[model samples]
Structure formats: C-alpha cells, structure tokens
Target: MKRIPQCDNTLGPLDFSKMHTVLVDVDVFNCGAGPIPQDGRDVWHNDFVKMPFSLSSYMKTGYTKQTNTVRWEVIYKQLRSLSKKTTASVKDLEDAIIKYNPKYKGQWSFDALSSLVKADPNGSNYSPKLFQKIAELALRLPELVKKAVPLLKRGHPAAITLSQTQIACLLANAFFCTYPHRNFSGPKAEYHNYPSINFTSLFGNASSRKKQKLRAIMHYFQEVTAKKLTGLVTFERRCLKETDLPNWRSSNKKMHKLHVASYGTIENEGKGMLQVDFASSWIGGGVLGSGLVQEEILFIINPELIVSRLFTEKLGDKECLIVTGSQQFSNYSGFGDTFEWKDPHEERLNRDEWARLQRQIVAIDALPFKHRSEQYNMNDVTRELNKAYCGFKGHQSNEPDIATGNWGCGAFNGDKQLKAVIQLMAAAQAKRGLAFFTFEDESLKQGLQQTYHLLVTERTTVDKLYSLLQNYCATQQAYGSAHVDLFELIRINFSPSKSLL
Candidate 1:
C-alpha cells in the first residue's frame, strides 16, 4: 500500500511573535485572562444559558402538590444510578437519557446506540464500561464548567473559549441529550438557525458510517475520562460587514507563495497552517445525522469542534468561524461513503502560550450550485470571492499562511478550476501565502502549479485577475454549453503578443 505523504513541514514555519488573534484579552493569551462579563449590549448573550452559573438558572422542586420539580438535583439521581452500574445495557442507557429529557421520550430513537452495543455488547471495550463512562462524564457538566457559556449569537463578532476538559464535558452532555430547548428546530424555535446539538439524530440512524462515527466519539470519552486533559480551544465567529469587505473590482494586491501538491491532505500536510474547512452554511453540516462529507468528517475526528454547534449560530454568507487549538483524536482513510475510522492520533504538537495546541482551523462555506453554470454569474462569483476572502484575510500581520484546495468542489457541485482561482485571488488580496492540497489529483496539482507560475511571472495583480474573471463570466454565459478552462484563458491573456519587429 502507498504510504501517507509528508507536507506539514513543507507548508511553512510557525511565527511565534505576538500576533493579534481573537483572544478576549489583547495582551494576555489565557482563558483566565479576564472576567467573563454578562450581556453588555451587543457583546455577549448570556441570557439564554440555563446552567448553574447563569442568572437564568433556577430551581424547581415539588412546589405544586409536591410533584413538579425542574431541579437538576432530581436529574442526577438517575445519572448516578446508571454510572455506578457495572453491566448497563443500551436500553438502560436510553431509559436514563429519556428520564432526564422526558420531553424527547418516545420521540428519539436509539437504534444506532443499540446496534453499536450489539457489535460488542459483552466485550471489554464496548458495552457496559463504555456506556457507563459516558454517563459519568455527562454528570460532571455542571461541576466542570462553573462559568456560564454564552451563545455565539448571530450578527455578533465574538468568541467562547473553553478548556479541553470543558469541551469534553459539554460533548458528553450532548451525547446523553441533556441540553434543554435545543431539541426543537424550526421557524419559531429559539435557535432555529443553528445546527442540531443533541446526539439524538446520531443515535437513531443505524448504518456502517454511524458505527464508525460512534467509534471516534466513544474513543474520545474513554481517553478524556481515563486521563487528565489539558489545553484551551477557542471558537470565534468572524463577520465581514459590507463596509469591511474588500472592493474586489479594484484592488492592487499580488499573489504570494504557492506550494501545490497532489499528495497529502489539509489536516495532515496542512498542519500548523491556517487550515480551511469546506463547510456548509450550517456549521458541522449533518455531523450528527446521515451526512458524512468533508465537514462532517472534520467534526467527527476532532470531536472537540462538535461543541460549537451547541452555541454557534448558523453562519452568514459574509461570515466564518475560526477554531484555534482543536486536537485531532483519530485518523481515518477514504472519502465520503468509503470513510473508515483509523486508530488514535497521538498528540505530538507543542502548546502555545495559552496552552492551546499549535493548530488553527477556519470554516468557510461556499455556494452550493445545482447547475455548474450558475456559479459563473458575476453576482455569484462576487459572493464566492467575498466568502473566501472572509476566511483568508489575516486578523493580524503575523498569521500563518493558508493551506487549502478544491474547497467547494465535492458534494457542493462546484467547478474545481474556478474554485481554485477564486481561492488564489482571495489569498492574494489577503496578502498571505497559500499551500494548495490536491488530495492526490495529479492533474489539478499540475494545472494549479502552472497557473501560479504564469501569474507570478507576469506579476499579475488582484485587480487584473478580477477584470479577467468579469470577462470569463461573460464568455461562459455567451458560450452557453461549451466549457472554458480558466487556466487556459489566463495563459492566453498573459502570454506576450507576437513581437512585431
């Protein structure tokens, strides 16, 4: 079998200077940096959290006829009973989850959980032990996260940074479906725009893919519960207001460095660089459901990121989410339907000043096109450019260069060549270098490298490329069904005219 390629060291070096990031404190880079204040106008929305640390927290116990009680105190009795059990069945686990989430009783299914347990129902690794550990972790949510978690609401440029332990505890709660008011989703739902949080959807869908997803998630609980976890992870929602967006029609920026390769992947080869996630408008697109594409795969491996769905609002077109210091727990082979969960990934990365792993990821969703020609419309092209720019633009001068490739080309029905050029232009405008990963597509690797060479040789500026795109869009519309290669057109436009002696 062919070995995995090495591209992490090739992407670029890490700059240790104090680059301005989305950290709450400008100077201090720790979770303990400052006091997390309550809702101060447009800053934070702590009004929604029902956890013990929030003002909205209340106790309800048998006040009416000594029967109605909403206290979590009553909820812990069932969780503790399940945790102490040495031979709990999948049925017992489901019963316990439903006891706490009574509203979802008879509504949520547990087929996936039952199927996973049956695979090794009596084994040392599966069943009783694994199921029990998950309950214990879920029970510790209130104790672990003593501070209220603010919803990373819409139209707000804000962040919520939590320690790895806090993230693990939160995910454990999601696994047991303990979050309140999060199960409902629709037009009138409180968080109608956000992705589903509870793991009910994941637990109900029984398939080989679901089994693999459970393996990764279960492994995370085993590791975190058995050992001491460290480091901080942050989720920042960045919005590019209309005025902050670049005037793509007239910009004089030039492309920086380019390293195109057909081998290696974004997470592997692109390590330590600003990795780009080809995400959906709803972050972690269908991770807890039937979908298993790029975005879903990303969230599964790094379960820490799955916690974002609990608070992050649905992303806007001009917005992106930057995750700093998330650790990859498992590695896998295959893409889409062929995906399989490989073994554990030893955390070899060094920690930063704030105890976060030396890792950064930016999530940017591209337009999903039904018909390929729809992307060539100038309005659509402009939107794509701005979306890429929103993710690529540097928060500070010392940021690492970007590592990406074929961003919206897979299930989104995007043209690979056009997507590549859009990213190039966005990277150039952002003034950062780029390392393009072709995911073993040699042809794309060659095409991208040649295009980069031509663009650099002629010293093509961003505005020049923008003008070329305008003409290409017009050509594509006029030609109708005929396909035009974007790179070939660039060569024709950049090639020096025959010298007339």
Candidate 2:
C-alpha cells in the first residue's frame, strides 16, 4: 500500500504524484485450470420452455407434453375479471391462482398471506385494494415478457433489459402462481437450483417473520403498479474461464488502496462504486422462505433484483451476476424480523451508455460453512479465494473499485479477518482498490488497518500471506480448545523485533 501525503481538512484533496512512494514487485495471479466442460445437454432445456413473454405466445396455450400446463385464455380471463374489481379478498386471489395451477390446489398454503392481511396495519383497507392491483398488474405479464430476451443457460455472456413496470408485471405473475412446473422439489426436480419464483413460499408456513416480509413485498407492488417506472435495468451473468483465473499462490502484487470506515453502509457510502452482494448461490437465499441478513436486506430494498431469480441459475464458483440500472423503489429500516418498509424512494441516478442505471451490484455467494472448522481447510480457502477473485477481478481498467464489508461474516459465521484478507488479496491481484465498510464494528476496523500496515511494511506477497494462513490453520487445530486470532498469529510470526528490526 502506497501512502500519499495528506492536506489539512479545509484543503482540497491530496496530490498523490507529489508524495514519496516505495515501489514493489507486482506478481501475476492465476487460478489453475479452466471451467469444467459441460455435456451436450443444455441446462435451460431442462427447465424452460423457451417461450418469450408475449400475448400471442400465451393466447395459443394448451395442454402440451411439457410439464407446465397453462391455459392462457383461462389466466387472461381470470385476471381480467380481477382487474375490474376495486377490492379482492384472500379467497378470490387463491381461487385465481388455483384456476391456473390446479395441480397445487390442496398442497399449497396461504396461511402467511391470510396472516399478513389480517395483521395489516390498516386492516382490510390495504390488503383487498393491494391484491386487486397486483392481480391487475399480473394480467399484463404477456406484455412485460413480450420483449424479454430469454436468458438461456449456455455458458455465454448475455443480458436481459427490462423496465420496472415489466418487472412488476412478472412479480405479479409470481404472486398469482402463473409460472408452471416450478413448485416441485427433489434431485430430479427441473428447477432445483433456482429459488422459488412463485409467492407460494411466502404464503405458506405463516409466522411473524413472514408477515413482516409480506408487508415489504406488498408495498413494492403498491408502488410499481401505482406508477409505471421509467428506467431500464439489465442483469448480466459473467462467467470466468480458467484462463481468466489468477495464480493466487504466486501473486506478487502489494495491497491496493483501501478505505476503512466504522460507520455508513456500502450502498450509501460506496455509491458510484461497484457494490458486492454477499449472496446465496440460489440468489435470494432464504428471503422468500425464512432467512434474512445482508443479502436479503439488499433484495428487499431494491426488490427489482429479486426478479433475477426467475432466470438466473445457481451460480458456479467461477461465476457471478452483475446487475446494472435496477432502481431502488423503497426505503426500509431494520434487518430480518425487525425489518419494515419505510417509504417510497425517488431514484435520480443517471443512465449509462447501455441505457441502464449507473448503479452496479455484483452478486457473489460465499461458501456457507456449517461448522467454523470446515472453512479452515486449504481446499475450502482456495474455493473462497477463487470465488471472491472471480467477483473482484475487473474486465476493464477503468472500472470502479469494490465497495464491500463483512461479506460472509454475518449469518454465514465467517471470520471477518480471514474474509478481509481474502478480499484484499483478490483485489490486489486484480489491480483494483477497495472501500471496506466494517458496518460499525470498531474493533475490526482497527485490526484490519493494523494488519494491513504490517503486511505493507514487510512488502508481503500474497504467497507469503497464504503460507502464513497455513501455519495459522495448523495452530488453530493443534490448540483445539481455543481459536487463534489471524492478525495476532501474523504479528507473532513477523514480529518487528524478530524480523524487521
């Protein structure tokens, strides 16, 4: 890490060129091997009908040999009738969904939805009206998917651009359970890797947590259908080949620029920078089910991102999803069970060359360790290194640095010190800087800064850091009763009195 001279608080930004600097050798990083070869079978063919969202496409629907049996006329007529109503009851919505998805009539549950409406702050006043609006919007799914490019799973670069209105329409369909063959589960299930696109999960297994989530989701529908959103959003899935992976064990790059803060969130403080979403491979994670953490919080506030679940397959370790131009439609307070929908947000960000919003978020799911000890193995460490590197590696030199913090540290129970070092090394290998938000963890802020300073002073290479991790892991196992602190282990190994002095 190169340090530039600073100016007074009242002065303008510091001039970096004028500052004294130490040059260190830069190492080229590579991940061994290329992406795994796929069989001739296409993953999309296993799950999707390859049907585009269009009125004509749905108009001719009949019982085909396909798993999903949707009668387009039946759906259109039911939605059309619901659209005419100023208010709709829970039973009416259930009947409409059953009309289209007769297969799950008895199996499906709506306890959560019923609870939500009953627990509504405004009582029946909002539930009936909101259900009516969602039903009406869902009727327009044909129009929404009319131009939606099919996101095939062919391991190639592709993007789907759609408006907020289009997203709302699709979500409304999700609410009505219009998507067929999506309700089953098993190793042989067609859409196993994909998160449940239908709202069935949210409506079943009623609990206080479910009620709160419905509030946020219902609020999202209320806003979108109330006004047609005017911006375009694009979801791009980027797959990295073995040629693109870095040789992590031999990287010679020093740490890049870093900014650590004890306060402020990645979304607010790291604006204009590429934000990292600590996600589950299944995309929305347990959001629809019963899990909420950093990833779920992000999806709830920027609900448009949830639509990605419809097309995105489970992310491979070498792959990540880059969402651009998705607008924030609502503001919220708290996390998990405490979460609440606050107010409608007005997005003013400018669009980019692709007509997408300037906002960019990269979704990378870290390995969820059931036991803390499971993450200390070398193979596990390498997997995480590759995962973070895959997301942090930049395609263009001009791309903004990453804005991330406590990536897998929350519910995933990751060690913050280990994750921070992994991200630092990955970012360094990619020649990009980082803006890490400690999420108000003061101790982590100071510990990371001190450890980073020591590594820089030692001119430590990534290989050296990796070697140190090996020793630390061994020590942790040997001393089974107590866990070793990573920064402390490094300090003891490279003490100034023993080495630098």
Candidate 3:
C-alpha cells in the first residue's frame, strides 16, 4: 500500500546533517554528558543497584557467614551450569533462575515462558539452544558492561551510550532476573524510583499477550547470540527546566509544517524523524505486564528499548526519554489484543557516526483521565503541552521533525483534535515539523486536516491557539457533561469567512 502523506509543506526533505546527538563530538562514547564523568555512572556494589558481580560484602547477603560465600558466587554457579547445557526446557530455566533468586521462588510463575515454548509460532527458530545461548550471554554481564549504569532517575538529566553487545549483555542479565535490589518497589525501597529490571514480571501470568511478547523477546536473544551484533544505543532522559518550559499563554510562534495521513505508522512514515512513544509515566508502561498498547507494542518490536526499564526511573510530567540507535528485531501485525509477532525485522536503518542505529524514539507519558472532561482544565492542558515539548525540543540545530499521532487519545481518553493541537504547538515551540499518522481513522484524518488547514490559513500562532483552548475549556465547563469537538470550536472561531476545508 502506497502512503500518500497529506503534505502541507511545499518544500522537499530538509538536510538532516549537523543535528546534535546527546553524545559529544568526542569519540569517548560517554561524551556530551552533564555532571557525569568520562566513565558512565558506576553504582556497582551500592544499594541503589546490585550488579551480578558486586562483592558479597557490598551486597551484605546473609550467606557470607560460611567462609565468605557471596551472592554473585551462587548466581554464577547456577548460570554457569545452565550455560554448559546445549539445550534446556522452560522448567529447567525457571529452576536455574530460582536457584539464584530464591526470594521469588514461589512468588513468580513461569507459565508464560512454558506456554511460549510449547506453542511458539517460530517453530525451530525458537529452540532450547536459544535459552542456553542466553545463559552464556547472561554470564558475561560482568565483562560486557564494565561501566556502572546510572539510573535515569527523575529530574536529573543524563545519558548513557553502550554498544549493542553491551545492551545484549544487560538484557541477557535482565532475562535471567540477575540484577539485585531492583525487584522491590514503593516509597522506601532502594530502586523504588526505577522501573522493573528483571524479567520476572514477564514470565508470570500466562496470556496471549505474554506469548506474543515472548516471541519477540526470544527472537531478540536468538539474533544477538547468533551473530556478533554491532552498533550503539544511547538513552537520554530529558527534563524540562522551569526556565525551559514555554509560557504558552505568551508565545506567538506559528504552527510548524505538518504532513498528516490516515495510513502508515510512526515507525515507518516517521523514519528519520524523532518518533514519539505515547508512554506511561512509569516508562515502558505495561510491556513487562499484560499491556499490549502502542507503547508496549513499540517496545516489543524494538526489544532493546525494553532494556531502558533496567535503569530508568518513573518519568515526571516535566521529563521525557529520548532513545537513539536501538534496533528493531521483529515485525508485528496488529495492535493491542490483536497483536501478533509477524517475523524478524531486517534492521537496515543507517548507523550514525557513533555506530548507533539512526532510529530515535522519545517517550512522553500523557495525563491519563478517567473521564474526557478531566483534560479540559488549563493546568492539565499545560502539563500535556509541556510534556510533549520536553520530548520535541531540539538538542541541536537541523534536528529531524517529530512523527506521532493520536497520542494520549486511545486509552488515556484524550480528545483527538485537542492533543493534535497540543503536539502542533509543541513542535512549533521546538522548531521542528510534524508527521502525524491517524492510523486509518478517516474521520480524524479528515477532521485534523481541516482543522489544521484553518489554523494555518488563519495564520494562528501558538499563543493565540493556547488562548482559544482556554475559551473552549470554559465553554466546555458551562455546557457540563456535553462533549464538544475541538476542531469545530477552532473552525467556528477561526473560519470567519466560512472557508471550505
């Protein structure tokens, strides 16, 4: 199917050179970081994050009583045993992981893993050798990533760049649930601020979603172990400083160029553009859980992105995560309940100078509302706008445009036209263009095109649009539970001449 993108831009593709990445121009790999030093944040042996090789003394495992046996020793003994095997059953893998992580022995379930192994659609491609290969990779955690990974904690802006080999190693560790002190949660917990790192959550609660998710995840391990993967992936958590947050009520910036269409997806049509991940505040959302939404599905296809769950903390409304160079491993056929792992994705995207895949994704969670009326308030409106702006803001000159559509509109209950305007305002504020995919909603595609045409035709600026939203909010309040279409409001107010859309 040919994608006929609705082109509002009269110009051709702009040169994407000279765009700044989170990494510095230096080849140091960890370049361009703020307070963080040349070596990445090393919190090994600390309570914040317990690495596989952290000394038993540092980890303070109670087992140190007998001739100084540490936690990692027991972990490696079990993992080493698994690695020696040419093949293993799902039950064998579960038993090995339980030997190290005995705390969750009864708490966790491997029904999902077993189910995948039994009915895995990949047939021979998904075999027990893949599990043994994963164990071999998991045992190399201490070597593949020497630098201590700092948690992309809330509010602190930082970036981590690691080779795909390094990513594979870390994910391999995650697959085995080897990382310590990360399983706990809540206010008093050490890694309470971070997302779940272990694959324990994924292995439980057997369902169709988990089966499909495992297919993609297992495919990733198969590919990484089958070949010596090259390239790098960088995860940068961007925070909107109080000074950086735009005063939407005062700004006069006009709408940027928009290419709207009903077909294509952010990953396809928005390639080479800053792709948007309609994320949850807790980062990867429900990818580890039963969720199979847009965000979860995105993480499923690009399993490397799932690695961010290991170190990234919950995202604040003012913060967003920009991932560069992560490779996509599988193709899928549907969204949500209908999602199925189609096949392996031939990752042909060009690599950047840093040897990272050129693909970039921004994770920004929107305000989830129980009722659509909750979003009309100016305070919530400003929060969503600022959130998108934090992700859309340019780090350097000649940055690529944003590729997104219907963000926060599906399960979050966001009004389509309103979110569209909010994103348009953010892109304009960030000085980038936008490519919006309506995902086959012809009504939304037609409505959005008409509304955008009116906004552009009237030469409306961001500040002016913001003020109009305020008016619409008030009108919505006065009208009570009755819903109002934002495009209708914009058209009625801006289209004084009754221009045909």
Candidate 4:
C-alpha cells in the first residue's frame, strides 16, 4: 500500500495583536450607489422577500393594533434631532429606542449601555459622540432600502447581492430596534424560526459579557459610518434535494487530506479555505438572544451576517447557508461566556469573479441531543452525515478544502470523536481535504492521527466504517459501561499487524 499524506496537525493560539488594522475613512453615501452591473439582476431570486418589510411598510403616525405606531417620519425626526450633537449620552439613545418601542418601555433595560459608558469614560468604544454618529447613520435606513431588493422566502434557490455599506445601513437600523414585530418568539410568530434581529438584548443586560459585546457592535458602526465599504457580498441559501445527497454507507472514496491541530480557530488558520460555522438550523442561533458559541462568535466578528436574520428562513436538514465575501469588522478574544471584542481586523483577501471577497463560509446546524445515547441511533447518525456533506460539497471544482473542528460538540453536547468521523466521512465523499481545529484539545489531535493512520493503512472504506459504528453503537446501547473508544474499537477489530497483513 502507498503511504498516505500526513494531515497538518500543528497547534497554537491566535494572536490578535498581530492582525492588520486599517483606518476607516470612506465616503459612505457615494459608495452606497448600486455597484450592481447590468447582468446583476439575473442572479436575484424571483420570489425573494415573500413578506416584504420596506422602509414605508412599517411607517405610521397614530397607533393601530394591526400596524406599527413607530412611524419612519417619527424615527427620522428623533435621529435627525440628535445628529447635530457632538456627543449623546446612553440615556439619549435609550430614549430614542423607547419612543419607537413604546410597548417595551419599562420591560427593557439599558444597564449594559450605562456600564459601557462607565467602564471607559475616555475610550472611543464607549464615546458619547459615537452614539450620535450611529444614530445619524441609522436614519439613512429609509434611503438604503429605498431601491433595495426584497429578500423573500422563496421555495427555490435564490441569492441577494449588496455592498457592505448598504448592509451597514440595514444593521444600523437593527441596532436602534427599528424592525417591528421582530422581538417575539413562538410557533405562530412571523419570524418564529429566525434568530432575533434586534440589538435590544445586548443593550439591556449589564454584565462583563454584555459590555464586551457592545464594544464589538460599536466598532462595527464606527467603521461603516466612517468609511466607504468597497466590496460586494452574497448570501446564498441552498436547498439540497434527496438526489443530491451521497449514499454514505455505500461510499468507496478514500479519506481526503486531514489536518488535526489543537490550537488556532478555523477562521484565522483556515483563511483562503472554506470555513464552517457551527450554526443553528435557524442560522445565527442565539446571537441576538444569549447563546454565544462558535456560531455567535462568527456572526459578531462579521456583523454583516446579522442582516440575514432580516429575511432568511429556517434551514431544513438538507439545507445550508453559504455566505460569500462578508467583511470582518472587529477582532474578538475568548470563547462563549468569556468572549470580548479586542480590536479591528482589516480583511485582505482577493476578490472573486463575482466582485466579492475570496472568503467563503457554510453554515450547517448539527442535531442537538437530549441524551448522549440518543445520538447513537443510526437515523441521527445518517442525518448528521448528510448535513455535513450538504455543506462540504463544492459547487465549483476549484472550491477550497473545508476548515472545521469540534462542530456541534460544544453547546449541542455532541461527542467530538463521533463528529470528527462524521465530518471526515462527509469530506471524503465530497473530495475535499479537512483541517480540523481541536481548539487546544491535545488528546484529540493524537487520537485522531492514530485512528486515521489505521483507517488509511487498512484501506477501510466508508461502508466498512459505517458498519463498525453500528456495532459500537449497539454495544453502547446494550451495555453502557462496556462502551469502547472509537479508536480502540477499530484497533481491536482491525489491528495493524492482522488487518494490514
């Protein structure tokens, strides 16, 4: 047998201070002009924005049960009134938001905003003047959406392309809580399946965590409002048909390139490659709620993605969101509860044929297990294989290898070994290499290398591994304590001396 190429397994922590930082100072209005070429309309989805929320749609002066009372004219007046001020207090911003969301007057808190201001009296992140600037930018929401295309919930594949500056305008509106009827959640709610879009949650919760979140968001507004964003970004929601799915248990493909590392995040280390966002089926997960993990961290760093919440519907098992060219506005430190905004990141990736950046990200939500044993069910296993394959499969032959690690293992409580195998199988079928980031798990790095070496040496096909998993799962179900490690199971069944000989 030929020697298989060893996977890259280097490990280390990301150094944020080393990242390049650029000064933001572009003419936002001039750049907002439609960069769409004459053929740009051809790529737009026909039935996009099934439920359109135009600038004029929610505008109303008097209160009505059916329509929003927070009129656009009223919002414009309040924001415009504050535009001339050199600085505005947290109370000033809160008052403006309350005027629009009268229903949540007493319910909402602004302790976080107050704390941010107190934390750094002289810091630009909490500057009172910056609040006024963002408020001024938020007022431009009317103009930004004036000629903007609707992003409808169509049954077929569709895409929406817009400039980063235009996205900033929409996000500014989100920051001010302008989108009506988006705060609620339930089965019958209009956007029940979507993550929350409003920034009210981040503003109210006064804590070390919320303060860090505020820093990231504030930095995003400062950059967009100050500079002329110069690139295009596309949000594509792909729905995979049953025919498109690979038959995992019957596959004959060998393992693609494998890299196991214990340090560095997929985003920084995997640059120029296809990155995976461990997302919720609903997309952003609890980004606007309280859930912060891999998915939330990705969104906060690239705030432009948050706009997808305005229109993207919940994804099915065979579906995924491929975001191309979204810009990263801020640098962040820590993970989950300890996440904090560090500094700015200047994106330097070359542009693609579509005028977007070369960066590509696929969002694939993993199954959340109530009990660890529930994941052992073959039905669930197959579902995960299909989901990962749906995201890893390349639309173009030139697509880069996938960069992922411990997907669905964190908040979802998935077993890392099982998920690693699942992703490897899916990537093999897709014919793409895998760069797995164990995120400082040294044991995983060594175990994965040994297990993969065995699989390569014995020429173990996907079907054979699938069968092995079946027995392992059965044993797990029948005798819980008799549960065997995956690598150990493979060793016992196909020891190198016996299986290879």
Question: 1-501, model 3: which lDDT tens digit per residue?
Answer: 111122122222111122222222233442422111123333554323457777742333456565545667877888888878867888888998887777777899999988888886348348767888998898887666555665677887877766678788889989998887777888898877778879989998999989989999988989999997757678888898899999999998988888899999999778878899999988888999899999999999998998888878889989999998889989989988899999899977876555677788999999999998888889999999999999989876457778999999999999888899999999889878889999999999898888888888888889988998999999888888998889888888789575544
Write model 4 residue lDDT over 1-501, tens digit each, in one string: 101112232212211121111111123313544342211121123333321234434544547746654266667777777777777788888888887777788999988878888888678665667878887778765445444344425344566666676678778878888776677888888667666778898888777777777787878887887887767677777777888987777889888889888998888888867889999988788777566689988998888888888877778888888888888878888987788888899887766533467778899999998767678768888899988998998775456788999999987889899999999899888888899999999999999988888888777788887888888888878876455587788877767676746
User: For every model shown, what is its TM-score relative to the native structure?
Assistant: 0.88, 0.84, 0.90, 0.87
How well is each residue in 63-169 modelled by candidate 2, as lDDT tens digits?
65353333666777787787787777787888887876777779888988887787673642255578778877887655445432354353555556555666777
**Predicted structure 4: clash tally:** 8
lDDT for model 4, please.
Answer: 0.74
lDDT of 1 by residue, 97-142 (tens): 7776766779889998788778856543354587678778878765
Which ranges of candidate 4 are over 4 A from the true structure?
1-70, 147-149, 152-155, 497-501
**lDDT of each candidate versus the true structure:** 0.78, 0.72, 0.81, 0.74
> Which residue pairs does candidate 3 place in steric collision?
none
